[model samples]
Target: MKIYETAGFPNPARIRMALAEKNASDAVTFVPVDVMAGEHRSEAFRAKNPDATVPYLELADGTCIAQCTAITEYIDGSFDGPSLTGRSPFARAHISMMNLRAENGLLNAVADYFHHATPGLGPDLETDQCAEWGEKRKAVATKTMSYLDGVLAESPYVAGDAFSVADITVFAGLAFADFAKVDIAEELTHLHAWRARVAERPSVAN
Candidate 1:
């Protein structure tokens, strides 16, 4: 398998964490895609992913998988390791719900703020930015911190007691937040503690 991704990007980081958790990081070849240089938009790269996104995975037989969620699902299911998506029906549903919440509420919000409000990647890549909308999304991201903190206050993990893809989503989101300068409110004690715990995991710490 060939993994096309750029280091330090939030979505890519999520995939990396999943790979580490699955102990499959050494099984694939890592191909760096330079998003900042607009390499992902090139014809060669677009042929693999028309959406022109990184963190794409190409299976040995030539199947390409895009989107962090889909790629994570594929990785968790294909590899012979602990399942990050969950094993049972109820567990799967719960993890998916929390994962979506983290992705939509926190990750997407921070991404919008970065691409629309700030000079993300570069001007050439972010020509259609909307500062107004970005501001709104930034606020939404901030609001999500509180919601996640509340969730963490009740459970050890985002979905429940077990670490799942939802926790990975939130972890990556928080990492992106650091780059975007989106401060988590100091009052979000539970959230901070949860972050600390997740950071200590080998998958994230490295």
Candidate 2:
């Protein structure tokens, strides 16, 4: 399998982390796509993903998979080593629910702020309203993060005591927010500690 990746993008990082967690990193080839150069907008890439997004996966038979969540789940399902999803049925449901919450509450909000408020992808951002929207988004994201931090304080991971896909999904979005200069409150100490633990993984370094 071939994975089209970008160094600074959040979605690709999620898949990469999943690969590492499942011990499936060696089975795939990495292809870097330059987002700054607008390579993803090219005809060749659009053919692979009509959405024109990065973090594309090409199966060995030449089928393409887009979207980070789908790709991560596929990888986890295909591999046998340490499941990124929880071991039990209840754990799986919890992780899945938490993952969706993180995506909707944090990741998507950050994307809206980044694309519409900031000068994203080399395009000039809009007016003060955009910035206001961004502020709102940031607030929503931080509040959700604070709640997750409280949960993390009680449990070792976001979904439960086990490290699962919920942690990786949330981490990818949070790390991207850090790159974009979004600040988290100092009071969320549990989240800060959890971030450090996730960073210590080998996949995050790459």
Candidate No. with top TM-score: 1
Candidate 2 segments whose C-alpha is farther than 4 A from its true place: 124-129
Q: Once superposed on the true structure, which residue ranges of model 1 sit more than 4 Å away at CA?
A: none
Cα error, residue 100 of model 1, in Å, equals 0.6
TM agreement with the true structure for every prediction: 0.98, 0.89
Tens digit per residue, CA lDDT, model 1, 90-202: 99999999999999999999999999999987888998899999999999999999999999999999999999999999999998999999999999999999999999999
Q: List model 2 lDDT by residue over 1-206, tens digit each.
A: 99998876888878878998877899999999877777888899999988888798999898999987778878988998877776678877888899999898888777767776677665522334477787788777878888889898999888887788888978977876887677777889999899899888776766
Q: Each prediction's Cα lDDT score? A: 0.93, 0.82
Estimate the TM-score for candidate 2: 0.89
